[model samples]
Target: MIELFGDATGNSIRAAIALEESGLTFEPRKVALARGEHRAAQYLQLNPTGRVPTLVDSDGPGGERLVLTQSNAIMLYIAEKSGTLLPSSAVERARALEWLFFFVTDVIAPNAQAFILSRDSTAAHGDAVRRLKERAFALYEHVDRRLAERPFLAGRVFTLADIAGYTITTASESELRWEALPHVRGWLERVGARPAVERGRRLFRSDA
Candidate 1:
């Protein structure tokens, strides 16, 4: 079994949702960031960066455990481990990876950094942050355009590309609104309606 260390609303939930959708059993080890658990000694030893969603894979050879810190790395790990969420063809797989890379580089990271900057009000700004937000929104618009034709990211099936994109993109809405992006919004509703995503959403809901 794998143990995932993360908070409730973070990408750990995304990993859990992916694992559930992958039909793999894993232990959910909650690390309460609000209580400063992620900065604690033990977790620091596990992840020097003190990040959440550290996946401790216990089934590796010689009893050696693998600790994956980044959420994208964890998603890719679980995706490859299950071998079902990714497309079968080489070209399709390459396209899936292409979208995955685009989401991380073009969409999630820039928007998140700018969102943090705008929220914090301390970060220096110039054409950089504006360009960051612009590029992020532009990539989102591109995603909306692609989703207008296909229900999923890679193609017809709900692959790991959608899983990766859905988690970060939806969360980015806290700073970047998707309502105006009708095509992306439509895709979000379609993917968000999945059973696993619903379960994951309930995990963050106060009413749940």
Candidate 2:
């Protein structure tokens, strides 16, 4: 059996969306961050870093059990296992990786740093946080420009790049200048409309 332990954070949602899109059957285990569940001994045994979005697969390659802690790694594993979420063509596959890392490193990393800084009360990091956020937001303009040239982030087909882009864009929706990014706004609408994406977004809801 495959099990995914996570909350509703962007990283977790990205993994859930990839699993859903790849048609993988896995149990969704919610890790309550507010309750400090992720740091519990049992959970820490599964993830030494005390982070959410850990995946455990009992029937991994050659029947060996697999444990994956990183969200992006889990997405790639799903894609590899299910033979989806990535294009078969070599060039398109490269494009998917390019755009996926573009969002993960360029966009998501800065915002994540800003979030950490905003939560730290021991120091005055307002200017640093603001600068990080500005840098992240400015990168979205490039995503908008790219979307204007193609239907999806990695060209004609939907791939992991779209999953990463969709989750981060959704997380930053209210803060973004949507009116100026028609292409990104439209892409968001399209990606959000997917059944898998919709279900993934709610996988860790209180009611769910």
Candidate 3:
């Protein structure tokens, strides 16, 4: 059995979405970050970094157990295990990976740093936060351009690239200029309408 320990954060949501989309039968174990549950001894044993979205596979390779951290790594692992969420063609897979890293590094990283800066009270980081946010948001135009040429980020079919792009796009929806990014707006709507995406999004909800 697979157990996914996570909260409702973007990284956790991404991992949950990948598991759901991969058609994996997994249990969602919510870690209440608000209550500092992630820092508890039990949880820390699973992930020393005390981060959300840890994956525990009881039936792993060679019939052994596997514990994995890092949201992107977990997503890729799911793809490899399930033989889905990635293109079969090596060329297409490379494109998928390209866009996946684009979202992970170019988009999500800046916004994450901006979020941290915004929360820091030791010094005034408003300007820095603004700059980071601007840098991240501006990259959406590139996504818009890419989407204008194809149905999905990588190509015709949805893959890990879409999964990565969808979560962050959803998180930053309000900040995006929808009117100017018609293609991205359309892509967002299409991806958001997936049933698995819906279920995955609610996996860590308080009511779930």
Candidate 4:
């Protein structure tokens, strides 16, 4: 079984969704970031960086071992290893990777950093958050257009691209006006309606 270490939020959500999409059985070990569990000696030994969502693959020659860190890396690893939720065509696969990068760099990272850095003061970081939100909206508009043309980001079927993008983009729903981008709004709903996504979400809540 795959062992995932992270709380049910942000990047951890991405890893959970990907694992569900891969149809693999896994266990989630929540490293409560707020409670400083990530900084504890046990977790630091596995992840020196003290980050969440460290995946441990237990099928190693000796025993279980940490396989990967970083949400996107874990997503790609699950996709490639399971040989599912990825495009069969070369062009589609490339498109999937492109969209994955676009979501991580353009949408997730900037806004997340802004929120994390600005968690203490509302006024001090207002301008930074506004700029980040604007950039996020612009990126969402681009995604909306692409999604309008295709059923999913990578062109046709549901893939890791959607898992990555949807997981991150959905985080800012309350802050973002997705209604302005009707196509994106509808796409997000459909993506979230999947049984696997729902199951993943349910699993997370149960764990919490």
| Model 2 Cα lDDT, one tens digit per residue, 103-127 | 9999898999999999999999999
lDDT by residue for model 1 (57-93), tens: 8884367878788887888888888876788888778
Q: TM per model?
A: 0.85, 0.98, 0.98, 0.91
Q: Report the CA-based lDDT of candidate 3 relative to the real structure.
A: 0.94
RMSD of each: 2.7, 0.8, 0.8, 2.3
Candidate 3: segments with Cα more than 4 A from true spot: none
* Cα deviation of 95, candidate 4, in Å: 0.6
Order the candidate numbers by TM-score, best to worst. 3, 2, 4, 1
Rank all candidate structures by their lDDT, best first, as comma-separated numbers. Answer: 3, 2, 4, 1
Give the top-scoring candidate (lDDT).
Answer: 3
Provide the overall lDDT of each model, using Cα atoms, as 2-decimal numbers. Answer: 0.76, 0.93, 0.94, 0.82
Which of 1 and 2 is the better model by lDDT? 2
Predicted candidate 4 versus true structure: per-residue lDDT over 77-130, tens digit per residue: 888778888899999999998988888888888878787768866458877778
Stretches > 4 Å off in candidate 2? none
- How many Å off is the CA of 88 in candidate 1? 0.8
Error (Å) of candidate 4 at residue 195 is 1.5
Looking at model 3, report the run of 10 residues with the lowest lDDT sum. 171-180
